[model samples]
Target: MNPGRPATGGSTTTAVLGALAGAVLLVMVLVVAFPDWFAPYPPERTDLRAVLEGPSAAHPLGTDQLGRDVLSRLVDGARLSVLIAAAATAVGVLGGALIGLLSAAAGTRVDSLLMRAVDVLLAFPELLLALLVVAVLGSGAVNTALAIGIAAIPNYARLVRGQALVVLRSDYVEAARMLGVAPARYLVRHVLPNVSGPVVVLASIGTGTALITASGLSLFGLGPRPPQADWGAMVADGKDFLQLAWWVSVTPGAAIVLVVVVMTLVGRGLQMRVLR
Candidate 1:
């Protein structure tokens, strides 16, 4: 019945969502780092006897065209999917933050040049920009991650610059300026801390986008090579077999969707709490 009570309830829900995301993230880390622990079968182990089988007690998610266990491949794929996403997010945020911070702190001429560059990048769709990078670098897991990261940089840079500008205009920052504080010192000690909340929230959201982009690249044969399990690769492998046996593609595709959905949910939760 009370406005404060509804706000409190929303906070409680956000807290619960955050907790759930943490648990899921932990499990994913373990699965990615040591896939054998959770995977019932070796991702590469093949059995002609079980080729293209549907869900069964022995093979919960079923077997692929080559008889590789779907669940095992999904587990193994966590490394490429989740790790690449995390790495891309880190690269994008760090690179963008550096540029953004400098652009905001630097005088008008430098800021104009830097932001103009960022504007050019922002003109391209994120996926298209990633594709362009991949085309130049050639396909591979590392390259895919880097490409996605690069594609993500402009967005973060713009966000960070806007946030930093707001902080720079704050009363405390003006007071520091009046007190003869050095620009560099105050920019770091004051502006960065104040602007980081939104960046963190954006990074979480960006990770989900990176994950999907990585998978899409992999689907194009730009990801890990054969026998290397990655959600995108798994989906790629199963595409031809969909008419014959849907599980080969469906299982890994489901994993990609599930992980991305969870990441997005966590990001939204963080945004609610951190930016509140």
Candidate 2:
């Protein structure tokens, strides 16, 4: 085989995977945007007589302990979950990018100082950091999202700084600098554009993590509160009847797993495509 054959094969694989991921993501978006359309029953509607019923044509995923349609709840949960995740990711992306740009544009000493601070933030586990932030800020979906995004900032900062450093050192960038290009102009036109691809790919993966973290917060009763169809809360509520009605918890858990897996595939595909 030719020496370059492996790279070509890898590229082909990434292309196929990316296409598949895109398709799945499209479906997920549709579900999230118009959950009522996909959900057969109102997510919060309850039937005392149908409580904890197993799967049937009327309720494919079964009824929860409260007789709420498991499938409908899961579908409804996606709307809130994805919105939180996307918002958190956006916060991380914007905040981290700005920090990274400041570090990259500044001199080496400033970069070192900024990065060390970022490193300190990264030292804590993201979930723990988010918890602390949430504790200080108090509960609710917006607060939870803000907390998650704050914790995620260090990761994005590191990624963007690394990518920016490389772009800054490129021959063209150096030539532009020497040719009297304004710092702001080059940083915007060249560095920002170059770092964006990696930032976007990281955001794709980060959204999945953010989603899980948001769910976890909700599980702890820190997000969205009761009566809302939250995946994590669904799992929490179902745990009491786990022995008798396992489907209650399992259905939402499975949805979380599937979504996380799909996002991961999409992110990985984006990474490979960017590297190529």
Which regions of candidate 2 fall more than 4 Å away from where they truly are? 1-16
Model 2: weakest 10-residue lDDT segment is 2-11
Please write out the lDDT profile of model 2 over residues 51-130, one tens digit for every residue.
Answer: 99998999998998779999999999888888888999999998999889989889889999999999999999888888
Error of 2 at 275 (Å): 1.2
What is the clash count of model 2?
Answer: 0
Model 2, residue 161: C-alpha shift (Å): 1.0
Write down the lDDT that model 1 would get.
0.87
**Can you give the TM-score per candidate against the true fold?**
0.91, 0.92
lDDT tens per residue, model 1, 1-276: 775554577767868877887888788778888887889987889999999999999999999988888998898888768888998999899899999999998879999999999999999988899999989998877888889999999999999999998899899999999999999899889999988998998998888889888888888888767767888888888898899899888887887787777788877887877756
State the displacement of the C-alpha of residue 12, model 2, in Å, after optimal TM-score superposition: 5.9
Residue pairs with backbone atoms closer than 3 Å in model 1 (clashes): none
**For every candidate, C-alpha RMSD to the true structure in Å:** 2.2, 2.3
How many residue pairs clash in each candidate at the backbone level? 0, 0
